[model samples]
Target: MPLGRLLLITVSLVASTGLASAQHDRADWDRQRARMVEAAIIEAGVTNQRVVSAMRATRRHEFVPLAQRRLAYQDMALPIGASQTISPPFVVAYMTEQLDPQPTDKVLEIGTGSGYQAAVLSPLVADVYTIEIVPSLGKRAAKTLSRLDYDNVHARVGDGYQGWPEAAPFDKIIVTCSPENPPPKLVEQLAEGGRMVIPLGERFQQNLCLMRKVNGELEREPLRATLFVPMTGAAEERREVLPDPERPAIVNGSFDEIADDEMEEPLPAGWHYLRQAEIDAKARPDDPAIAFKNDEPGLPSQALQGFPIDGRRVKRLRVGFAAKGEGIRFGQQASQWPYVVVSYYDERRVWLGDEVIGPLRGSFDWIERSEELPVPASAREAGLRIGLLGAVGKLWLDDVRIAPAGG
Candidate 1:
């Protein structure tokens, strides 16, 4: 062959190989993302058509760090530096569903980590106003959203506790971080009949709650149990400094009353970080007894498990349990529905038992049966157990009733 012909053949082969490689990479990425959407958002009953469409359209990989792009679509939270987290897709979908946003509504998002949640909301609602306390994150998110053509989103750097007062009377408000309670300002900013979803608790564990304003009264409901970083900035400051007493303490006695050597530096209120192990030990049971009305099929299941329990109720359930492992399975059938498994260890760290139940996909009348299993001694003195719910057309579990056996 002539030298020119040989060179052209070599170049053609190299180009073909590169094209094939790129096609394979794109295919793999698409498959992984599709699985994530099916399992986390769709199966979980995130039925808002616009929300689902926006979630599918946005490329989450672009919002994460380059090193973490591979795991972007996984059904777990991802760290976005600054000790903040981009919430798991399932959580974002769950909270979005709870808000039940309408096409013309204006939504406010607190805690704009990486701007992923805000991005998801921008395409669903008429307008999205988001606030991030960290100046750097706020600036980065604003640029990212702008580049993505999210013209309806407005990003700002400020204390989230104060909310966006200038954009008051929002149709819906969502706080990504956990607060001790819903900030009064957020409630005041809500339009009449508007809803606000927030995680309420101390620094460690928090309860997912929804508050609706009606006739100048706030109606609160505990939806589920979840964990989130505490709402930082002004909210944290407000909690630390309570009003001073009417009078100061005056000890006129000798130095014996207050020995100079007995003094030690006081511990900072926010400095006591709970280790992951301690947090797991203090974690609440996943399944608590809850009751519901109009248990419908094909709709998302409701769990009253997060309500504030009185001392008596807490004692009754033997609330403490060590989680061995938890997994979820998805399905779509006339009755046999998708469900989750919550396995636990006893106080001694031995495998204890597990519970299984159907989630709300449709109506409740179709649900048939639910089950629980206990661990066997052969399995390291701790056995594996499961809760199985039989075929039901559409069933929802509310107010999970869990108590220590023989307690």
Candidate 2:
């Protein structure tokens, strides 16, 4: 064979192999994005079509570092460097939908950690002005957004508390980080009758609130209980809801403290997602209990609540709760069954591990269950999740409590 012709054939074969590999990678990413949208965004109940489309279109994997890209579409937040994280896919979708974005709207975003939120909003609105306090994160996010062709997102490294005064009167404003109170400047910059969705409250826990500038005053509506990194810069000066971390325990464990808003769903205070196990007010009339029912064996119904803890002082925890079950059976996985999980987290709020209580199968009238789990030496926070985890049948829980094991 002639040397020239042989070399040409080898080059062609190499190029074809590279092309095939790239195509496969692209296809895999597309499949993952689709699954995330259906399971984490749509099925989780974000109904806005535009929001859904934007979520579907955005390539989340591109926003994170290459090492973290593989886990980008898992419906959970991923670290994006500098003690920050990209908001979970559902959170990004839910907040965007709550803002009620419009094609002609001008949106302002505070805390552009990964710029992923601004990227999602870019196509949904006319413009997006985002601010980030951490210079490194802000610069990286700006570069990512630009490279991804999100031309409408304008990012700057600055304290978000003051907001972008030059671009006042934004049609919609979304704050990704939490503040003890809505930054006054942000509220002022919002256009009249404009909508704003922000998480406001304590340092550890907060309520995702939807606010409207109505007749020169803000009307606040609490959407759900959530946790977000605290807004830095000016917001750090205020310390209103700074509860003592040394004393960490469950609140409203008896499923009491119902919302008074007749227009909204009644969920136990300090908790969110009654859909997982809605409050059965009449089931135990005098003592309300949260109930979970899943006719479909493989679908899980769960609710989570986070509490501040100082693991250094509290080395072990005892979780106690009263639960009743009927026809409880495991789901597709053996690990999925009725149980209460106490998840511990490190100082950075990264999950360490979980101490789960029960597989509570079969039928039972009512019984009290308790278990003790050791806290990791580096743990600083804990979260409690209760429900039938991908299990079939009904489960009711009440009087849930977590305390230092010996105490």
Candidate 3:
């Protein structure tokens, strides 16, 4: 063969191989993503057909950091810089399901982490107004959503606690971050009968709460347990002052009969009790490690424990304590109610299990054995640990207790 002809043939062969490889890469990415959507979204009952389809079509990998691209489809949260996280696929589906958005409804999102949720929301609603306090994340999310042709989403860099006042009356609002209480501005912005799903509590344990505006009143119901980073911005500094002390204490004796006058005493402070039967760590001497502290009411208790935490295996952490405050102050807004804060940790002090249950409102609530929180996959085999980060006010914690699975 002539030299020029032979060279051209070789070049053609290389180009063909390159093209095939690229095609395979693209096909594999699609297949993996589809499997994730099937397992995490569709199987989980995110029944909005349009939302499901859009989630399947959107490439989550593109929104995550390059180092975490491989785990984009995993049913776990991924860090997206600035200490923020792109929520797991299941959480996205779960929260979205709670919204129950309609085709013509306009939605608002409080955290635009990686823009993944907003991207998911964009195609499901007529418009999405999302706010992110982190300037860098907001900018990056905006760019990513725009590049993907999600024009229906308007991403802004600002305080989400303020909500988007200009776009008042959103049909639905979803807050990705947890706040001590639902932002008042958000409630004011909701259209009558519109729903809002927010994670309410301290930075540790949060309750997934759904609220509806009825007759100018915001009615709320606790849905499930969850944990998320605290919402940041000016709202964080906005303190709630107690109402007039002269007024009578508000008491509903129906749930449990405790005198309203008795409820006025500040809870006890700085006490930890361990059950004798559960003290096997004394034999092991170094097995289960524990730590505790006390803070004022409405503050979160910071505690740390380490030993062994089995996945999906239920355990109980009974925190017997009282707060030293005039009484549990329900926020001026109905949403700001005091709740219990719990954290599961591994040996390294990395936050693993975080659960917040609320506005038990100065009542004694025990975390049931069956309700043991799951430690994140990253920290599961590292040895069980727990901590009391902080609390609402000065409270006495006595009989600090823990019960492992089957114990």
Candidate 4:
């Protein structure tokens, strides 16, 4: 054989060997994930099958910085810069189990930290919308989640206190940071019949609160004592409202109650589909009517509407949600993107403000947003409308809620 031909053959063989070695290393990593699940997650008081399965499938080592990659599968949280640490495997599993996510559920996560929790949650639900306050951490985690093929996981950089409004209703909301109290905005964004798991209390004295919304009320159960990064931004200034473990705050702020047979449907009771005509009237004349609300429609989004906030004396009001606008092909830039809108009204059924709160930006991603409206001193009863408009895409809301600030 010619020398040149022999050399080419040798090079081809070397390339194939290198590829095989890389594949082998990947397999080893997969094995490590499984072992971690069994020892760190499954044995750590989390027995949920879906959570266990998701933990096994996700590659934790891929989420950490290169220097700390080998420690990813260990039971502890690791720093991902910006002073944030990914939740430990057991903690992630425990919080995930606390939510009791369903296959069709949409989940919202506050504190994207390393995006590791979102990755762990991706396989367990239809969507995982995460928000990280630190821009650098958000950018890095977003990159890592994408590289790892966690397409269902979406991330954004913003203050998580407001929650994600356009995604205003979530089946579950999990807060990784420790807040002095459950952020009222987060409570307002909790969907009826949904669950929110958060670390509540001051700094190191935080306790894990498993909050479930049922019959328009929040049932608070302290699962364990834990330490976490204190929630920053608006949360730092939050006046602590010590909640009664026996009589927690209620958000009965939106939707109807779910009966045993209606578990498959997204809308709970007290909620109805908003008509396109009503939505079109709100749109600018030059622009097209806001997208239709139905899963059958391409880029399908289902919109739910409820009565405005009941007449009540409240000092502060909050509205928001965890949302994703998928396939949102917008000609406008991010600043002009349509997001979740919280329209305010008065008790006499008269519309009070023309301003809407949220707008969706980009295509196919989840973003967290929130806005607080000051309760006018003269207003006796206020009304609110929570829904998505003026965006073209499949939008999702989980853990939707509406409530007075704090308790």
Largest TM-score belongs to which candidate? 2
Clashes of 2: 0
lDDT string for model 3 (178-273, tens) is: 778888899899999999999876444356778898997788876654556568786567624322211211111011211122322211111111
Poorest 10 consecutive residues by lDDT, candidate 3: 269-278
Give the lDDT ranking, best first: 2, 4, 3, 1
- In order, what lDDT does every prediction score? 0.59, 0.85, 0.61, 0.64
Ranking by TM-score: 2, 3, 1, 4
Please tell me which model should have the higher lDDT, number 1 or number 2: 2
- With candidate 1 superimposed using the best TM-score fit, by how many Å does residue 123's alpha carbon deviate from the native? 1.8
Instruction: Please write out the lDDT profile of model 4 over residues 24-126, one tens digit for every residue.
Output: 9898898888877875666445788878888887788888888678888877556677656777788888888888988888889999988888988888889
Off by over 4 Å in 2: 1-14, 65-68, 260-263, 273-275, 297-300
- Runs in model 4 deviating more than 4 A are 1-3, 239-407
The candidate maximizing lDDT is 2
lDDT of 2 by residue, 1-407 (tens): 99999999999999999999999998999999998898778877899999999999999998977877889888766767766778889889999999999999999999999989999999999999999999999999999999998989999999999999998889999999999998999989999999999998887667889999998779999887777888989997875677665777787889887643532567677774334568888657598898899877656487778787787888888889998899999988887898898887776656688888887989998898888888888887777888997798999999999888888
The worst-scoring run of ten residues by lDDT in candidate 4 lies at 245-254
Against the true structure, candidate 1 reaches a TM-score of 0.58
Q: How many backbone clashes does candidate 3 have?
A: 42
Candidate 1, residue 361: the lDDT equals 49
